[model samples]
Every structure is written in C-alpha cells, then in structure tokens.
Target chain A: MRTIFYISDGTALTAEAFGRAMLSMFPLKVVHKTLAFIDTEAKATAAVNKINQAYADSGERPVIFHTFVSIDIKRIIMSSQGSCYDFLDYFVTPLSKELGIPAQPKTHRTHGIQEDTGVRENYDFRIDAVNYSLANDDGSNVANYDEADIILLGVSRTGKTPTSLYLALHYGIKAANYPLTEDDNMENLQLPKVLKPHRHKIFGLTLDPQRLHEIRSKRREGSTYASLPQCRFELQEVEKMYRREAIPFLDSTRFSVEEIAAKILAETNIERHRF
Target chain B: MRTIFYISDGTALTAEAFGRAMLSMFPLKVVHKTLAFIDTEAKATAAVNKINQAYADSGERPVIFHTFVSIDIKRIIMSSQGSCYDFLDYFVTPLSKELGIPAQPKTHRTHGIQEDTGVRENYDFRIDAVNYSLANDDGSNVANYDEADIILLGVSRTGKTPTSLYLALHYGIKAANYPLTEDDNMENLQLPKVLKPHRHKIFGLTLDPQRLHEIRSKRREGSTYASLPQCRFELQEVEKMYRREAIPFLDSTRFSVEEIAAKILAETNIERHRF
Candidate 1:
C-alpha cells in the first residue's frame, strides 16, 4: 500500500485537503497520516523521520504533501526520503522574483477569526446568516421570507437542511428551506401560497426514489415516509412543480452537500457576502 | 484601500483562506478578489494583466496570494505586477532535490469530490455526520445519544447548533447539543439525568451574558428568556456546573465556530473522521 504524509506548519488542513483530493484519483490503497503544527526544525525533522521510515517499510517512496511558510522547517522536511510535493515552493519562487520581494513566512494563518474589523464584520455576517438559516429552516418562519437571499424548496430528505446550512455558513448567504408535504397534493404540483411571491428566489432539490428511501429509512425505518413509493411520488411531484414554475433544480442523489451548494451558488448567481 | 488577489489552479479556497487569515493581522481597508480555475497559461497571463492594471490604477503594489501546481501557469501568474506570495513554489524546489524525483505539476487537485472509493467514503461520512447532527440538534433526539462522537451542553444562544453543525460538516464528527433549560435548576448546579451517562463525551459552551442576551433578544425580544438578568443567571450557574463536573468548556462569545470546533476536537481528543 502507498503511504501519504501531510505535513504543515499550521493545522495541515490545506495539505490534507489537496492530498486527499489528489490521492482519490489514483487506483491504489493508501494509508494517510498528518503531521500538524510542524513550525520548527525539530518537528519537521521528526516528521521527516517518520515519513522516511514509512518509505523504507513500504520499499517505495512515500508521497508527502506539505504546506509550510517557514523556509527553515520547509527545507528540513524537503530533505526527507520521500516523494515530496511542496505546496509552498512550486509557486512562491517565481512570485518572489516577479514581485521583487520575499514573502513573510507566517504560520497558523489559514482558518480563524482575525482581529481585523473587515474580517470581524465578515465573520459576524456569516454567523448571522447561519443563525438565520437555522431559524428559517423547514419553513419555520415564513414571515421573514422577504429577507432570504435564496429559498430552497424540496420534499423531506432531499438534502435541503444541510445545503441551506452549507450556503449560510460558508458563503454568508441567507438560505432558507421549505419542505413540501403531502398536504401540498402531489398530483396538483402547485406552489405553496407563502412561496408564490418569492418563487423567483426558489431552488429545488430532487433525488432518486431508491436513494431518497435509503436516506429516510435511516431516520425513520419502515414508515411510509421512508418507503420507496413515497419517495418516488414526492420527487416526481416536486420536480413537476419545479418545471411548471420554471424554477431551477438539481438532483442531490449523486452530489455531496459541497457540490450541491456550489451548483446552487453558480446557478442562482447569489451574491456571497464573505470570502 | 488596498487590493488583494487570490489566484489558484483549483477553487482558490486555500489561497483565500490563508490570505484572509494573514491579512486579518493588518489593519487595512482591502478589496479582495478571487481568480479561480487558473490552470492554463492563457488564464494566468490574463490574470497578470488584470493585476498589473490594478497596480497602475492604484499606484500601489497589490497583494496576490496564489496556489498553482502547473509550472507553466505558475510562471505566467508570477510575472504579474503585484506583491505575489506563491503558496506552491516556496518548498517544492527543495523537495524535488531530496526525493530525487522532479515534481509532477498538476491542476485542480483540491476541493471537490472524486470518483474514487476513498474520497466517496469520506464524503459519505461527512454527509452522514451532518444529517446525524441535524437530527440530534438541541437535544431533540436522545435515542441515539450513544452514537454521538461528542456532546455540547450550553444555555440558549451560546452557539450550540452552529458549532455542532460545523463539527459535523467539516470534520465528520457526530456532534449533538443539549440546551440547559430553566427546568435544570442553576443554583443547585445538578447534572441532568439524561446527561450523567454521557458526561465523559460532554463539552460545555459558555458565553458572555451580554452577548447571550443580545443573541436571544433578536429571537425573542420581550420574553423573560431573552432578558439580561436571565442570561446572567444561567451563565453563572452553568459555569459553576462545569467546574463541578470537570467538563471541558469554551467561551463562544469570543471565538468563531471554526475555532470553537477546533478547540473541542483538540481538548476532547475526538477523532475527526474526515480531512
């Protein structure tokens, strides 16, 4: 099995994220390990030793993905016995040359609430959006419908709540979701009275009947709500409503929440309030 | 105002995330722009011209943060008229020397789900954790208490929901939250019967009474639950209880959900199932 080591001066999330995505494309069994907070030469050396040992054991050079701003630590780790993919080095050398200036190597500057006013304001906006999405979830507060940046309309278990939360937290988009119920009448495919005025902001989610059934079964087993027929009927009717209203929609059966959120943002042209 | 450009081969999320965190340390009015999907030399050259124009217009060196794995694209972007900090180049050159293998520069190997089983497994785990968190939020469903990776206990508006959701979506941790209701007497500081069995997995969240009051006031303006006196009483009692139980806790008033989740994972030694 191939071994992958993610090394970084900070939490190593960027290295791990990129490495995982890359390794996923390769057809091989992989063992992944992370060496985070490698901000010093000693720590980098220790990480290198561990990676080297893994390489020796496997009789093949282990893959090392790293993100280090500190040149000293970066150098030490780079000298290790592995096939190193340095995230920092591959671009910074050319950049420094062009800019006529060296970058200030700083650590732990990836994810946090910074002490800057603009960053603070952005964080607060995200918090507000997250709270707003939670409060307005599952059609909880229809009175605030006008304030929503985008409204997600779907049947239960169609991946509405998670998508709404993802958009709100990540992009600072005021996303509110409403679940279509049996009361709405599947055969009629009519928009709810409360959603008619806000139809322009609506996005729909649909999924395969079997997939929807499997998702709902985990939550409420053996119930009609979790049955394949119920899932099929709801998805079919909801999709019909989407077509009838000309509301943009996507199938959530094969997409993760990140992909679903990205698609929604792209399709809706919704303004993201935060970086 | 200063200008900041986040350039990347992929989504530019890493460049933006790190750049934002670093810039937060400086007190400046900055306009941030993201040039994503810069995998081609043409795209890189176009981006350089835009940066040069911005520099010409502002008469100031614009800051550019970038991550490009393709050497060709990286070279073009590095020729920009800006203060460019390349994330990839700062280490890869040395890494190539140590490994005795030149780096194979590729593009867009970050921030998306791949077709491989390992990547799909991680995505499935995150989605499951998110759904689990949502279903178990606010102590709503206690039947699956044993399945939680961590439990958060706090008063109303101490940010239990968002933190739980963040942990689930980002780290693939099955997090559940319980709100300390008025029914749980504060002065006595007794552990509730439901939580006693899961005390080892519990993490407490505390917030400044003023912040709690403000957060709640937005939800329920005139209710006693949102009153400053009520918030103060609950907070003081919760702290006392936390001290008695030796439950690790964090003050949510100061830190963002990301920070809070990171601390919880670190302090609790909770294994994150995803990168």
Candidate 2:
C-alpha cells in the first residue's frame, strides 16, 4: 500500500477533503496520515523528513495534499520526496483574477475560530446549535420545538439522532428529532399532538424494512421490534402518516448522514446559520 | 457583492470545502448557494439558469466551484456565465499517474453510503459512535467510560460537549465528556474516582476565564455561576488538578471545534475508527 499525507499550517481539514475527494475515484487501499498545525519552519522540516521516510519505506512517492499560508514553510514541504498537490494554491491566482482582488493568505483562517470576526459570533452559533440539539434530542424537550430550524420525525433506528446532530454540527441548524415508537401507537399512527403546530418544520426519515430489522436486531436481539414483519408494519404506518399529513420525508436507507442532510437542505427552505 | 455557487452531482460537500478553503485567503464578501444532487440534465440546465441570473443581477461573473461525475451535466454547467473551477478534475490526471490507476468517475461515491464497502460497516461506525457519545455525554453514564476512546474533562462552558460530538461524528471516535462543576468541590479539585482507572484516555479542556464568564452569562443573567471571580476560581482549580494529575490538556479559548478536535487527535494516540 502507498502512503497519503494531508499536511497543512492549520487543521489540514481542507487538505483531507481534497485528497479524499480525489482518491474516491480510485479503487485502492492506502495508509492515511495527517500533519496539522505545521506552522513553524522546524515543524515543516520534520514533516519533510517523515514524507521522505514514507517514500523510502514504500519505495513509492507519497501523495501529499497540503495547504499552507507561509511561503517559507510551504517551500520546505514542496522540497520533500513526494508528489505534492496544493489545491488552494493552484486555484488562488485564477480566483484572485476573477474576483479582482489579491489573495491575503493567513494561517488558521480555514478551520479556526478566527475565521469569524474577532468576537467569534459565528463559531458560537455552532456551539449553541449543538447544545440546542442535545437538549431537544429524542422528544426530550418538545416545548423547545418552536426554536428549532427543523424537526426530524422517524421510527426507532431510522437514523434521526445522527442526522439531527450532523445538521447542527455542520450547518449550525437547530434540528430536534422526535422518535415514533410503540408509544405513538404504531398500529394507527398520527402526527403526535405536540408536533401538529410545528408540522411545517417537520421532516421525516424512513428506512427499508430489512435495514430497520437488521439495525434493531443489533440492539434488541430476537424481539418483535427487530422482526421483519414488525419493521415493515411500523414503516408502512409511519410512511402513510407522512403522506396523509403532507410532511416531506426521505427514505434514508441507502444514504449517509451527509447525503441525507444535503437532500433535506436542498428540498427545504430552512436557513443555514453558518456558511 | 459577487455570488458564489457550489454545485455537484452528489452532495456538493467537497465543492463547498474546496471553495471555502480557497475563498478564506481573500477578504471578500459574497452570496453563497449550493446546488446538490444535480445528476440530471434538466437540473443542470436549471442550475445554469440560476448561475446566469446571478451573474446578471450582480453584474459580475459568478464564481462556481463544481464537481460532477456526469460529463453531459458538467458540460451544461460549463456553458453557464459563471467562471467554474473543478479542483477534482484539475488534480485527477496527476493523482492517477502517481497511483497507477485510471480514474473511475462515479456519482454518490464521495459523500454517500456507497463510499464504504457494500456492507456499509464503516457508516455504521459513525452512527454507533454518535450514539455512544450521546449516551455518555456530560458525565451521564460513567459506567461506560471503559468504552470511550477519549474522556474529555472540563469545567462548565469550556467546550467539552461540542468537541466530544465533533470527535464522534467526524472521526468515529467515542468521546465521553465529564463536567467539573461546583459538585466537584472547586476549592480542592481532584480527578474523580471513576476516571482514575481510565487515566490514559483522559484529555482536559480549559478556557480563559473571561470567555467562560461570557458564555455562562448568556445562560444565566445575574448569577454567581456566571460571575468572573467564580469562573476564574473554577478554571484555576481545574488547571491545577490537570497538572497535579499529569493529565494532557488544552486551552481551547482561541480555537473552533474543528481546530480543537484536530489538536486533540494530534496530541493523542487514540485510534481513529474512520478514515
């Protein structure tokens, strides 16, 4: 296997994003390493030594995806025995020309608190959203639904919790989820009375019956809740209620949290509090 | 102000990451739009119309950062008035040569459930980690500490919760956090008895007293818990305990959750469950 390095002066998150996106096209296994906060010349020199060692050990040039603000530090990294790709550097000139402004590169601007204004108000939005989502998770705090940007409705194990947290963490969207369980009378389901007034903000998630069965089986083995027939029955009733109530929903059986959140955002008009 | 668009046949997450990293170098304000799941020609044409309308409205060429697996849809987007940059396409040939494999373009492979093996086992790790973190949040379930990859210890409002969730969601690491409050005896702080057995997995978070005061003040307007003296005393005691116990710690006052998570991963040897 080959070595892939994501190195940057800051968090190197963008470098990881770039490398992962590029490598998804290739069906190969590789080792992953990240050297973050490499802001000093000494640290950059040490990183070059590691890159050279990986090349020596693997007998193949390591693929380096890096973003750096300091020219001196980046020069050291470019001198390493690796095929370095700096996506940000490659696009900077053309982007500057198109925007008619020179690029003022700065460390920590990509994934740092300083990216927001000095007050860090935008960063606060994310923390606040996370707190809100946690406090409102799983119908624990229905009284706070009016403060939510969106509410997620789903049966148990249909992926409402992770989706809600992802929306809060990534987009600073206050997403509270309510799980539809036996308590909701799955045999004849209706939108819970508490959720009726906030129906406009509700989004539903459903999964394939087989998928739901597999998921629940891992939690409560051999129970009716983990049986295929029970899973099918619950899903059929919940989905019917979705249509009857005219609530928008997604079958999240085959989607990652990122895909589900993006689909919801694309379909809904909820405002994202963070860029 | 100019307009910027992130368009992709998939979730458009990679495009957004690329665009945000590149734009952070320049001090420019622009409107942002994302066109996700544009896998069809009709959707591509509609996206182009939106891009062209934005150009006309702003009297400036819109900056488009796009990724697409469909050549036909990408062609339609290229014909739009916006200046498009495809970083994935730009880096493909070089990366392909370095890896000795031809690029296999596929939609939904980048940010979809299909990124994992067909079993979706890696996707399950993320969801499982999220559930674990939620179950163990804020010292709620101390008996499960042995299962945590890391246990974050911090005083109230020092950013333990968001950091824990970020570690779980992004890296698939089980991060359980315990809060050090007045209940911990701020005057004479010590590592709780329950955490002593898992000392190797402990990471401490501390914030500037001023920042903590501001954060707590928002939740409680005129209380001693939100007072500067109280904040200072609590943080001072916590830092003393961390050093006395020889625990690794961070002053997270100047970092975002991403930065804090990256810093923790850099300092620790905890195995990341996701790539």
Candidate 3:
C-alpha cells in the first residue's frame, strides 16, 4: 500500500536498483514510480507536488529517493512533504572538502553518452571481447584459441554460452566455450586438439545430474539426450575430465550468471577491464 | 590526492558507480577503495579506522559512500572522521512511514541469490534470448526469423552483433541480426529471401564509411575488402537498400553500445523486461 518514488537527474538506473534492493527486505506490496531526467526546476516542482498528493491521498508519507546533481533542484525536492532522501545533497559537500575541489554538478551526465575520451579505449576493449566471445562460441572458431582469455568446457546445457557472454559483456574478458561431446566422454575424456595448448586457460562447469536433466528436458522433451541416465553419465565424464586435466571447475546449479562470472574471474585471476 | 571509499552491505556496485559519477565532476585524482560485505559491526569499526587512517595520512577528509541496511553499521560509519554518506539513513524512516511496515535490515540480500521465485521466470527468458542472439548472430541461423522479437540488419562490423547481444542480455528480447552482404546490394538493393517475410520486424544500422573501414582493416588488413572505396560503396548501397526496403535505420557512428541499445529499444517500441 506504500508508494516509493525514485527521482533522478540522469537515467535513474542506480536509484531504481538501490531502491528495489532496500525495499525488498520488507514484506510489503509497494507501488514504484521513477521520474528520470528531472533536470529542470519546474520538473522538480512537479515531482514535489506529485509526491505530496500521494502522501495526502494515502495519509502516509511517500518515500522519495533521488540522485540529483543540481543543488537548486535538490532544494526544491527536499522541500516536498514526503520522506526525502537526496543522494548528492548528503555527500557532495563532504566530497568537495575531501577532494579539495568544488562539485561541478551536471544533469544526465552519469549514464549518458560519455564525452570522456578516456573511456573510449576501454569501451572498445569490451566490444572486442564481446565479438571474440560470439566468434569463438561453442568452439566453432577454435582457430583463434591463442587469443582467448579463458576456455569453458562443459557438456550440453551446462550454461557455458551464457556464462561466456556474461563474462565478455560485463568484465570485458575474452571467453570461449567448448562443448564436451559424448565422443570425448567415451574416448577416455581426453582434451581436444584445439584445447590442449590452452590447458592453462581452461575452466569447467559442472552441475547435478537431476538439475541437468530438468534443464535438458525442457529443451528436448522425451528424448534420450535429455534422459536422466544420459545427464548423469555426461556429468560424471566431465568431472573426470576436469580432474584429469587439472582444470578448475564450478558447479553452476545454484548460481546466477553474475555469481558464475565472478567465480570464474576470481578463480582464474583474470583482471577485469573496467570502463 | 583524496581517498574515496565505497562501503556496502552487498556487492557495492551501486556505491562504486555513484561514487565514480560524483567524483568525476570534481577534477581531482582520488584513490578509490571498496569495502564490501560490511554486514557486521566489527567490519564497520574496521572501516571507520581505515577511513580515519587515510584521512590522517593525506591531511584530507576521506569521502565515504555507503548503502547500509543496518542502522547500527550506518551509525558506526557516520561516526568516522571522514565525510560519511549513508544511503539508508536518509530514506529508510520515510520509506517505513510510506509503506506502513517496518524496515527489516538485511545485509547481502540485495544482489545475492534471489529467493523470489517470480524473478526466476524472467531470468530464464533472458538466458533464452542470449542463446537466441548467439545462435542467430551474423546470419548464421536465420531460420528462426518467425520467433524473433526484432531483427537487426547491417553490414559487417556496423556493430550489429554487440547491439543484438546487449538487447538480449539486458532486456530478454529475442534479437536476431543478419549481415547485409554484397550480393544483396548488387541485386538492385533487393531484400534477401530469408528476410523478406519478416520485414516488419527489421531494423537497419548505418555508420560512417571511415569508421567501418577502420574496424574492417583491423580485422583483415591489406585487402580490397577493407579499402576505403569498398567501405564507401557498401555503406552507400546499404543506405539505398534501407530506403528501398523502408527499414527504419539508425546512424550508429558515435553512439556507445549502451546508447545504441536504448535507442533501438525506444525506436522499436520493444518492451524491456526489467530484472
């Protein structure tokens, strides 16, 4: 029954995310509204009125979350008859003092098109990594094995492709994944020719057979490939390969793509190229 | 010469991003530190001392950015000698008032494993879209054109792949991209047979010839394909094809992947499935 207002001078993605994170802790059904691009005084005033109206209607104060860079607009928002939390107002003065420089507040500059030429190189790096991941996906373009930062080896439907893409997209890491086939499993789980030279850069993904069975069943219903015994066999063989090759492996059953990416980066000691 | 500290009870990504955005406004070279997993009073005390030490050493107050769910830890951080800004303290009371519920401060629950089953469906949607983008990248598997939410058409290296991946990764939109080849251009700007049926869902991307040349040359140097004339001819023909086919096009010469993705979503009226 509560209204949560997110106000921002920019994209308000961070405000939205932080607000959701904090609000989810309480067991309540809440109405969330986001007012982005609130750079003008008139817009700020409009927001204040909307918030006050909500408070009056519900007989409860609306919680206003804002990340505004303009002191003037922030003052107008702070004057609203709601529970006002301004991100910049609480920190800018102290930051100015600590840095020995005055704050130059710019509207919509946080997540907007960057005029900072310094971030271009990093942006290009990430784009290149993303392209590399696509090109080398599923071991299709193994000719460029030498350029990969890490090679993920797993059986079918073990989250190799998504993990690789997440790593590339988020960390700018050149990740390639090779699917371990049934032939490899039957042939004593030896490393493929293309992957042998990149042994040091290889990581494996493992999961419980039951979970794998559930995932594969959804993709290929009533098929032998998706059967429980087939999943169990594949997982056992992959674990054997990982142990035999001394490749670090992770069980991706309970982990999200974010967690999987963090683990891969941390385990491999790969330095993330931040933008 | 100042120190910037990002303290959080969770992953600290928001705290870090907010700190960076705010710090970039001030022209100062600041040393950045992230103290994550600050869920305990002991951790908060240690962070306070660390902030004090940095302040004492530099003779400048450190700027501490925090998103603490716990009031006790927030109090400890606010008591530090540095300039402390706690995201929760300024808003939690009002949010409680607005929601008609008490704030249950939990640490590390924001970005950790989700206990919410409702989000699980959306997560699967995103993963499926990512797989679709990878499978359909660069016209590799265009057989599923009927299933796509949107199909992007562009020449090679016109940023088709990255944009498609971004759309899929962020919004769970089943985006498939087809590269406009020379054959399609030489055939009197005709649409490819594979793309003719799904013309309504197609979007075109165009960029400067020089930028295209620069990107292609890096991939395949010293070739007619990467020559200026080739890039110019291809770009000119693609624009002609876009006009002939009546495909909505975007000039992606200077936009970042993030900007391009947003533009694509907005122009196509494609609903973004937020996480």
Candidate 4:
C-alpha cells in the first residue's frame, strides 16, 4: 500500500534522518511515498482526514504514517473513518525496541534556535567576509595578507583542516591555516615566507608536545613524525617562534567546542552577524 | 583567548546544540570550531587529548571541550581546568531541570540496509535502483535540478522549502522543489503536467483538508482560501485528482519528521551516503 508521511512543527533534522532511513529500510519495491511538512498540529490533522478519505474512495487501506512531539493529535487521526487507530502505537513500538537507541531527551526551547536557514549561506558568508585577511603565496589564493580573518599556524597533528571548515561552516568566519613544518619549525624561526608581512593576522596553535606525539603515533605509528622526541622538538620550537613573534595563541587543552569557540570570538573581537 | 573547539564523538547534535547555546547564552565569540566525527567514547578521548594539548600551551588557560557518549568523559571535562569545566554543568543542569535540550535523542541505532549511498554515476543505476527522483518546473536551473539527490513536489504549503534546505545543509544533497499551485496543480488534474515526461522522477506531497484549512488560516484568516468549507472542498478535489491520476503521496498528518522521511526513502528506493 502507498503511504503518506506527515511531520508537524519541529526542526528539519528528523525529516533528514527519516529521508536517510527510507532510502535503505525496505526492499526496493512496493514503497511509493509522499513527504509533507506541516508547521502546526491543526494543519497535520486536516491532512490526515483528506488522506483517509482518498484511500477509502480508492478501495485501499493505506498506512497513514506520522511522527511528532505530542500524542494529543493521534485521537484526531484515529477518529477518521479509514485511518488507523494505533498510529502512534504502531510507529513507536518497534522504534522503542531498537538497540543502542537514545531516547529523545526533551530540551528547553531557550537553548534552541529555530533557524529557518541552513549552514551553506553562513559558511559562504564567513568565507567571503574574511577577504581582507588573505595573502598570496606560490600560486596559492593569497593576496597582500591583509584580508585574512584568523590565520592558524601550527605543527603537524595540531588540528587545522577540520577547524578551518568548521569556522567557515558554523561561525561564518573565514579561517586560513599555514602549517609550520620541521625545517623552519625545528629552528623555531621561519613562518610561511609569504605570511611574514601579515604576521599580525597569525594565531599560533600551541599544544603539549607529548599530546602531539600521541596523535601522530596513532596516525602513522613507528614513523619518525610520530616519535615522542620529534613531536616534543617540533612543539617546543613552534612555541618559541610564537613567543618571539608575539602571535597571540590559545591552548585548547580543556575547552569544549563551545568554550574554545567563545574564547576565540572574545579575543579576536569578530562579530557574528547571525547565531 | 581565541579558542578552537572540537567534537570527539557522540551525536554532533549535542555539540551543535551547545554551539548554538554558546552563541546565544553567553558573551563568547566563536573563532574556529571543528567536529572530527568519531562514534565511541575512546575515540572521543583521543580527540580531547589532541584538542587539550593545543589549549595547554597557551599561557592563558584555554578551555578544551569534549562531548562523548560516556558520562565519564563528561565528568572529566567538568573537572578539567579553564572554562572547559562549564560544559558538564551546562548539559547536566538542563537535564536536572527536566528540559528538552538534547536535540539528538539517544535512540537505538536500528536495522535496515543503511550503508547504501544514494549517489549514482549512471542514469540506469538510478532508474534500476529507483533511488534518485527528479523534479521538473519552469526555468529551473539544471545545475540545481540535475545535481539534486531528491526533488520534492507539492502545493505551496506541503513543506518543500525547509526539507530541501535541510537536506542540502546536512547531507550535502542538492535538492530542488517545485510548487504545485492552483494553476499548475489543476493543469495536471490527470497527472502532474511537468512530471509527465519524468513521471519516475516525481515525489508527491499532499495534506489533509482540515490541516490545510488551519494552515492557510494562519496567513489569510477568514477568507475563502482559509475557510474550513473551502478546505474540505479543495481537499476532496485534490484527493480525487490524486486517485484518478494514480499518484503516490504521504498523508503527512501523523508522521514525525523522521518517520515520514523514512517512508519517502523506502518508497523512492533511495540510499544514504553519509561520511
């Protein structure tokens, strides 16, 4: 039988999860569907009646599936002549039994923001906003090093790439990171040659040397880069370079994603246009 | 005090909630934040260490934040130095107050062939798999439609916009939606006019009459468009068209966002490609 899925007011995450689930949950046939989104319960109930009548007229008993935050409306659906009585009962039964299941822990609306938009806009905005801090390097997109938002300088295993993407995605902040390698990093001297002019834009990512050693070892065990002394030396030299250059740096040792983000914002004074 | 935030593991939803909270609840500014998606507690600890040391080196005590499935890790962060200690307090305090703050409900990871990726290099693969559906409309960009993993078609209030944006931002899916208005919708009384040539490419969304009436009332109260009687009439007419046309649709009345999405994927025979 064909099915109609209804989702009343809530974030779109549940819808996405369901979309992903539908793609792989069934045997590729006998599953024809429509996905409708309603912003309120009154609208959802109205939709159920129309679907029930349509199925009844067609001489078929279709499964009018639904999921939502409340059970008050299930009565509305159940009362419909052709609608199933146990709509919630049927859906939640097996769902509640699944292993590794995490109960939908209720949350305060204050902590949540019902953003109508998504991350792409924010990501694109930040990436574009920090145009002033960017600089040019060997065929790289660097210009005069004046357009960068926050430039990250760190030795290997210091977490740069993902951080760059995240800043772009979540904060709408453009972040460019330059790696400090063994040659210059070991001497504790050279920064990215092109980055020298824009040293003020640089922020050193300092970490405990031993921690760097562990991270490298896990990725490429037994390699020289993973050796404890190698990490220790790199970290020490990098710290010294940061100190000598007077580049403001942060220690990320005990911050949550939230705390670190807060600190960075506080220090840099970069204003976020939208939360 | 510029901070780098990291997510070691669990549902990024929790971390994401906290991120949003930080943006709103405090005076913190966000610089660069990264989520290295790890599934379990051990991997989370590993991520924390990498993040921790980076914070450790900054002369100023930086917060290294971590959110893991384990209560132990949560405890560790609560007792950790710097502002990182605040996370445990933030998460638990709300829980203690019985708030519905955790958007990622702890649900059992269930069965079904979920590893399937929806991307297809060939048209035949899409048709055979019945995974990717297309949407046709007036002067729509091929760049938008052709790249779409899923396309949604329904009347104005069928919830196409939010669903499309959600899929795009979260799953990196290219999604396009077409409005089935009174004119276009009626023109396709026997079948969706635009969808005729690409019938296999269409996915329909329809709501019950009462629900539509209520929804429409919110925008244009006490008008023909929002009247209960008009809603009943329109819903009846629409259902007749759906049945006469033999179109597939989801009731959209009782389904949660997750359940409806699941039905759609199942019906469409699409798969998810998640990293």
DockQ of each: 0.25, 0.76, 0.35, 0.04
Q: What would the per-residue lDDT of candidate 1 be over residues A1-275, giving only the tens digit for each residue?
A: 66888887665766776565444334455677777768778878888889889988988678888887677888899899888775445555564555455655542355556654555677878889998998999999999989999999999878888899999988899999999988888778799999999988999999989988988998899999999998888888888889988999999776668668766765666889877
lDDT (C-alpha) at residue A202 in model 2: 99
Model 1 chain B TM at: 0.90
Candidate 2 colliding pairs: none
* Model 2 per-residue lDDT tens digits across residues A21-60: 9988988788899999898999999999999999999898
RMSD of 4: 16.2
Model 4 scores a C-alpha lDDT of 0.48
- Per-residue lDDT tens digits for candidate 1, residues B45-86, read 889998998888888788888877666887788788788775
| Cα lDDT of model 4 by residue, A212-232, tens digit | 776678679999999988887
Angstrom error of the Cα, residue B83, model 4: value is 25
lDDT of 2 by residue, B52-156 (tens): 999888898999999999889999999999999999889999888988989988632677766345427778898899999999999999999989999999998
For model 2, the superposed segments whose C-alpha errors exceed 4 Å read A115-119, B115-119
Q: Which RMSD does model 1 reach against the true structure?
A: 4.8
Comparing 2 with 3 on DockQ, the higher-scoring candidate is 2
At residue B269, what lDDT does model 2 achieve? 92
| lDDT per residue as tens, model 3, B135-205 | 88889887898889899998888999888988898778989999988767554667888898999999999
Best by DockQ: 2
Write down the worst ten-residue block by lDDT for model 3 chain A: A106-115
